[model samples]
Target: MSLTSNIADGRKKKRRRMKSDSDISRPSPMQSHIDACVSFKDKQVAARVTSDAKMDEWFVVKVINFDEKTKKFEVLDEEAGDDEEGGVQKTYKLSASCIIPFPERNDPSGTQEFPAGRNVLAVYPETTALYKATVISTPRKRKSDSHVCKLTSNLLCAYLRGYLLEFDDDEEDGALPQRTVPFHKVVPLPEWHRQRDLCIKMRLNSEFGVLNM
Candidate 1:
């Protein structure tokens, strides 16, 4: 499948038009936390980037605590923004399921799937260099020590391509390729918020449709 399907120019890809689910897979990181994450999906909103430039690194953010007053999840932003009266604020309101969790693959194999647990979510904007997102939940280790970290759509693609590229290089030179390792980490969102945009960009890709892996 081509990576340029729904991408419009260098800045936009409409999710409504995304018609493929081929890229969706159950990577190892989400094996333990999937159920916990599904429980919070309806209460979150995710932000992602459309440009390839922003997808190079990982975005780690903290999930906003559930609110009882407005009955919506609130996200914190390190970037300053102006209010209607021009006051600076660092928080925003997100719609339900706007953010969801995905598992990050470390040493990803085309033949394995992990059990579900907790995950984080983010949103992808139309014209940004990277997807913007907020962390939705803190990871808690289960009895089996199943811990998972979600990845942005761009990151997932990058990880696969990068590994493949390296493998190809080794193969062409008549050398055995090294095993591929997953490029993901499990960290606290609040601690990593200012470090990375802390988000993911994803759309359904028909070529990588949801495989129960």
Candidate 2:
């Protein structure tokens, strides 16, 4: 994806902490966290921007300056702009709503269980960019560590305790690819968006006369 152009503009990778798998479990970096980050300054965050392709996507950005007076934040994108722009790292002026603070590690037990099949936004491995994905598995136990069980075989046992995520855009000749992402790298979609998506799906089901018992 061509990830530049303004929603006020810029991009990269970042990670933070937070977990809610009960009733509040929905989308990532909850809106409340984003709202409380009003004093955003010198912090790494994920900012949803509108790119040249006209698609909204999340990117990791650093807040270089905050105009408290105007309630606007000036974020610096680590991505050097296009050649015509002299390949300089670009910055963006964005509203608070467009900026999502990284999750905070507030869970004392550190046992947040993300349910399987939940939609989320996870960092694409080896890159800072956040993209839509789904939870394939959330740290389950193996019936047997025998080589027959992929989840229990090899060093993957402890590793499976992290998360098995399937990227939405991952497609290889009609095959879907899954990756093992650390728990910290996965986040729920914002609650609003999650509910919205749910409502849309319900509507489609209703329209097709698909009833759920």
Candidate 3:
């Protein structure tokens, strides 16, 4: 083959290889959704009823079935009293975004643990933001491993139906309002501190600052 033709073929092959690599590195939409969806096996979860006008109350439920095609779950409301077989089980279909899984028992394999007074990044249900919070109460042994967290924000606390609306804050405070949240939603801030520091460092770097700007 001529030198010019050989060079062109090599370049085309390189482009095809790069394109395939990029395609393999990018996750499919369904895979991304599945990765973000909270696993709802045998554990109890809190789900917000979007159909309700207020959308403020969260119903604690157990997952009976998950429909992958619809991305919805068939849940049995635990708060509702039991009824006869097939009689008013209080079942509802909920989307993944509306469901929050309860925290599992502190196991040796996992690092997320809610000890009283410990600072944590809690998933604030009202705003769906992970904010700085303090563990006011730990989970009871018999009950679901849900922890009561006090948000550190100074924003006015509002109670609508059964949900507490609070702002996200990075500051420290002792007088913040408390709300109950699943233990799994409470992440230890220390584990993320290093990443935050690295981000700060990169933002302050001269080259990075100029590039980001």
Candidate 4:
């Protein structure tokens, strides 16, 4: 009777543990929706991921191609200089993580969802506006991988939402103008490519173009 009782207690404990595990297996509602959208879009991005699963700061992923018809985003690894000698080009496929909602108007709380977060209007004043940005990061092929392939502005934007501001270079000493254009812009992003000459170059339509950002 004693042995039987002990065995029954062990089974009860195992059942409790299994219940806990099942609870953890469920994904959040928002996360589940985001996953569905990305899976539908078939998009991807890249990032300089550390071995310990941390993202480096101020990196950008250049979007080489996008197919609106197919609703997919194509990404490529940005490289520096001419590799007259052969070198491995590192790139990843990614999809949008979330769906971007249409802009809202006349809300008591004015928050845009695109650029996202607070702009550093004045370090002294400390005023901000909120915005929302849909970000994309690549997933590792391995099922048990611990890290995402890229880091994105989604987290920062969420934290700083409703406090976005713009900085004036004229007022700032040694401040450079911000780039806002795609391909020509020098905005810091998740996949960064550094060149020794400080000249930014991109390949568009099988041709190389250089721009000073």
Writing each residue's lDDT as its tens digit, candidate 2 over 119-167 gives: 8777788877888788888755323345534634444453344678889
TM for candidate 4 is 0.25
- TM-score of each model, in listed order: 0.25, 0.59, 0.44, 0.25
Question: Residues 1-213, candidate 1, lDDT per residue (tens digit)?
Answer: 356753554334444335233235444454334444435433322332112444432332334554544444455544444576366534555433333333344433332222123222222222111222222222211211112123434323444432111221235457644332222322222323334433422223432355533
- Rank all candidate structures by their TM-score, best first, as comma-separated numbers: 2, 3, 1, 4
**Model 4 segments more than 4 A misplaced:** 1-34, 37-48, 51-85, 92-173, 181-213
Better of 1 and 3 by lDDT: 3
| Candidate 2 segments whose C-alpha is farther than 4 A from its true place | 1-40, 51-54, 104-113, 139-161, 195-213
| Candidate with maximal lDDT | 2
User: Among all windows of ten consecutive residues in candidate 2, which has the lowest summed lDDT?
Assistant: 8-17
Per-model tally of clashing residue pairs? 47, 8, 1, 26
Spell out the clash pairs found in candidate 3. Answer: 103-184
* Tens digit per residue, CA lDDT, model 4, 1-213: 699999999999999999999879988786675555444332322323223323221123445554444544454444432476356554444444211221122231333222333231111121111111222211111122124213323333232222223333334556533322111111222221233112333344224333332
Q: What's the TM for model 2?
A: 0.59
State in Å the error of residue 192, model 4: 19
